[model samples]
Target chain A: MNSSGVRSVARIVARDDGRGGTALPVLESDGPLALRRTRGSGAEARVMLVGAMSGPLGGDHFTVRARVEEGARLSVGSAAATIALPGQAKGEARYDVRLDVADHAELHWTPEQLISAKGSDLHVTTRVDLAPASRLLLREEQVLGRAGEEPGRLTSRLTVRVAERVVLDQELACGPGAPGGWDGPAVLAGHRTVGQLVVVRPEFGADPVTARVLGEGASVVPLAGPAALVTAVAPDALRLRRLLDEALTSLL
Target chain B: MSRAALLVLADGRFPAGGHAHSGGAEAAVKAGRISGAASLADFCRGRLHTAGLVAAGLAAAAALGTDPVALDRAADARTPSPALRLAARKLGRQLLRAARATWPSAELDALGREFPKGAHQPVVLGLAARAAGLGPVDAAYCAAYENVSGPATATVRLLSLDPFDATAVLARLAPEVDRVVDRAVEAARQAVDGGVDALPAASAPLLEIGAEAHAAWPVRLFAS
Candidate 1:
């Protein structure tokens, strides 16, 4: 219970009009977070998430929930990088996101990078529940610190379930001294930029090109639902971004 | 119920198919992250805290009678490497055979029937601990110990760095291993009530990445 924090919620539900068309009937949002409809082709309803607040300060708690109704499609992105700063209480910021995709629904979530400032402690968790025939693509990237400074402590966790069966669950922690040995080769290998992209579908298989895109500093892990979970880490943010672009392109 | 059963399961030569895998030490060694005993100690310590802690939590939860299928999915979520997942299921299958032959429990049989190819090795190990009447903490200790021991043994073979040095490396890690088991059992106790979400999801990114690379390797001493 950190005081002096901003609590925001973005609830979005995309509905299908039955003619292969998608509509956003519910975009109830509050606080410093807003969801704006964007242009997309076909049945895909694309939206951009804009943060009214400059960034998250220490002790800020942000919650987001988005649901795609049966046979509906929704694609989400952010307007800019999420800059996180330390708060007054614990000097930490927290983000909890929940996503649900109904039967035959599809969701594409590709957000901008998260830049953790010095002395900032951040925790982010995203949970997804997918019904049968549903699909979800989620990407999370983080830059440890601003230029010339050591990155603050951050922990990111992602949990995905298909039909109430967990398929992809991964957590990465980075800090001066934390659960993940930040300096050790077994964890980050002294890299500051870390990113993970998860794709859940019914017909997932080995993609050699995807494997090659995930080259040396990254990996492509296949989950139980024949889904693909790709993770990458690099000393440079731009380098990681290029690799992620290639990997995501292969998935397309 | 049987204190000796913990030792039996913890033994490296239990024929559980762990011998074929180096717990990522082979890759780390080849990557030059581990050249000597000190670096190997660091590698093993990191694995013990992250993957080791998470595995111990899952095993303890399974030993507490949590659903093996659910635990298997949780294990899958925690593991982000397909190659490592394959290795885990392979080890799980091998461990199931030994557990059924040794303990002969219906619970183990049900798990085998459910995951014919295999469950994650830690899930099977936890259930095997249950069938052997061991507690969650006992299972956690077994998992934590194996996490470090596997890498140490593998490093000894990979580097020819002297078996005695590797043995000393494990002895040095005994204290941390105990702490990991304690934390894992505590998490399992919470998971018994809060569900599998209460378990730890700590991970070692390089281990996952290295396993994927190692899987594509044309030749290697260990399977993962």
Candidate 2:
């Protein structure tokens, strides 16, 4: 890894102790990234991720691989927001995430916002593989550029599979003049920040209150095979986060 | 292969139920991203390279005799929004009815039987093209052209901006559209051996997001 670049890798796997106690996460990390484990009083364990540096910049690649074993549960979060800064060479920053949930396991990953500064480009690729009976709740939020500045390019590709079958495959490319490009009505309709929430569970029942909370310009679409997707856009990250949290809370 | 079959499939009036949706152009127009012919052309270009390319590739692959069920699942993966999925299936069912009547075949009938509600529109288009004895490239061209043409024609009604200008917008995009079809066909060839994973999955979130938003509009003119 370059001095200015941060190449971090961490994997958290939960294992049942064969007793009534909750399974703990096996944590590992390198570089400027820190992984902190929090004891779960209820039915799941918690893990907090923190970075010594600001965030991944140009030419920086950050990766996280996480899994939840059978009969185990875990929740992952970030210490603070991730700020992507412009690098010296103008290259794009990359975040690659891989997650797997075994049978009868659950994993909820709610990370902080990822803000891309001006002249910065960010690409995130997330692949999730789950067992037929596993459950997952994933939330990702992105804010393009700072206030009063031209937004940077951010492309996100997500693929979700259950029992080796593709459940959802999504690719989002946003920049100048892109569809849902900046200020476009059909896409974001001029919203600077966009957030997404995905939930897949066995008994994920219906909730009419969720749609009412999304209000204008936000939508909650229930996918086939016990999955629900929500996307919202707002003028700022705070507003978008609030809307996303509201919808997610209702679903939860 | 009857060459005229390509034209028949490519005609905008095939009654495939495409006229009801603006291809997300209505939201863009309402947001002021599509004010005139120039902006509309730009939007079409972006869509052509992204969603259009992906749709064309799927259509081409289906035309090459790829598994329709597998392609349908791949289409589901590529499409994240439920509203878009519903629209694609509706159009697929509608296209199946038309294709079965126009060019009766066992394959089309089986597909209809398999997916009574519907499959993705591109997959059905590919199967229809195959039933008509057309090649993957022809199917790709049809899907690619529809990607931009649907929105262009819809904008003509939304903005009432000169119909000539909208047609001209498509005319200028003809070269780019051909390029997209070429890429789609090439990807389809790879998909023949590499499986559905080889097909393009490039997506436009705004389209997915727009599809969802548009679906909620109780007062919208388009079905999607």
DockQ, per model, reads 0.59, 0.44
lDDT of 1 by residue, B31-55 (tens): 8888989888888888988899999
Model 2 alpha-carbon drift over 4 Å, by segment:
A1-7, A19-21, A88-92, A176-183, A205-213, B1-3, B27-35
Q: How well is candidate 1 docked (DockQ)?
A: 0.59
For model 2 the TM-score comes to 0.89
lDDT values for all models: 0.85, 0.81
List clashing residue pairs in candidate 1: A58-A86, A58-A87, A169-B77, B1-B133
Interface RMSD of each: 2.0, 3.5
Give the worst 10-residue stretch by lDDT in candidate 1 chain B: B76-85
Count of clashes in candidate 1: 4
TM-score list, all predictions: 0.92, 0.89
How accurate locally is residue A152 in candidate 2, as Cα lDDT from 0 to 100? 72
Q: After superposition, how far is residue B32 of candidate 2 from its true place, in Å?
A: 5.2
Which candidate comes out best when scored by TM-score?
Answer: 1
Q: Global lDDT for candidate 2?
A: 0.81
Locate the minimum summed-lDDT window of 10 residues in model 2 chain A.
A204-213
Docking class of 2: acceptable
